[model samples]
Target: MSKPLSPSSSYDLHPSVAYVQSILANLEARTGRTLEAWVALARAEGPSDGKARVVWLKAQGLGASQAGLVAQRAAAGPGHAFDDTPAGYLAAAPGYVEAQYGGKKAALHPLFERIVELARSLGPEVKICPCETIVPFYRNHVFAEVKPFASRLDLGLALGDPAAVADLSGRLKDTGGFRKKDRITHKLELTGVADLDLALAWLRRAYGRDLKA
Candidate 1:
């Protein structure tokens, strides 16, 4: 059998893992209840549906983010949801990135790495969270995401309203909407390392905006 996860286990040193740990570490202080306490409370009396559970938790005094986290853990139950532990999530993070770059999209891995490196270089607070299809970079909130394709990678930026900025006009393709709070208002396609400079420029602007937000 696999070893049990320990809170003190040596976790992946990625900034994203650290970022999540920071949130877990601060849960009690922020919500006046420990994660286990919140999970127990949620499972015992919270609504069965996830969205409703978040709303219910918020009514019980938890903030939006905290409520969501608690609801997610409760919904995933004990062994799932990355084993409902930081160590489990950290241990699984590398596999998540590997899966994203596997097979025909393998060639885009290097480009993705360059983008992540440049994004990380923007500041110490940048956190890289990898999902199944995209790797999101966060600063207070999600400022950017790198989505890979067989031939190119799309760098999505949360630049508020691209049209309102004259220099950004006609420079980026809209990814649907540019609402002020949209996590991804625009996308820049990158086919090679040559695109890194332009990506970094826009990334820096997005990162700065997130800092102020």
Candidate 2:
């Protein structure tokens, strides 16, 4: 028999823009990673401490705050809110803080700076997330258009070296179904179904129910 989804359950999506949102939502819940916690940690603790925490994260084979961003949501308490009604009241609108401040002061040794910086080198598409980065799990792709795919490999491996991004491109390539890079509109590389499920599975494994799914 086929193995059941471990920690991750299959999502019911309509294969449209809503599908991307669904995948991101599912991914955030499945993984315990969240931007809220990362931001709070960075803001409260000194940069050294933030970097130390990132070291711990790297040891685990993921970037510090980037993992949560890749999953597209914050860690679920303070810095961001889930997309669900009533709950999302906590999450900030995109760039609201930045616009209010009207400037970004660079830090020489910010905690998650490196992790987030390296992530920028990886994804071809990055946009200000309409949702919590921890939940969406990666910066939203600015697609001139969106496309549908059966799996996540094409986007993850688009930059040539899959290792430059996530670790599993080679592995995901062996999937039972063939994936495509179908383009729609300007063809932004927004995610569809598979990656979201993977993120969700990863989340369930990380949080172990200490946090909500």
lDDT of each: 0.75, 0.30
lDDT of 2 by residue, 1-213 (tens): 123222112111112334334535554365464445544544454233434545544554454445443323323334333333332332343232223223232121121122223333333333223232221223223221111233211222122222333434333332221133321111112233333344333222222312222
Per-residue lDDT for 103-209 in model 1, tens only? 99888877777777787678778877666567788888888998888899989988877666545345578776575456798889889877878888899998998
- Model 1, CA-based lDDT: 0.75
**Winner by lDDT:** 1
Lowest lDDT sum, 10 consecutive residues, model 2, at 6-15
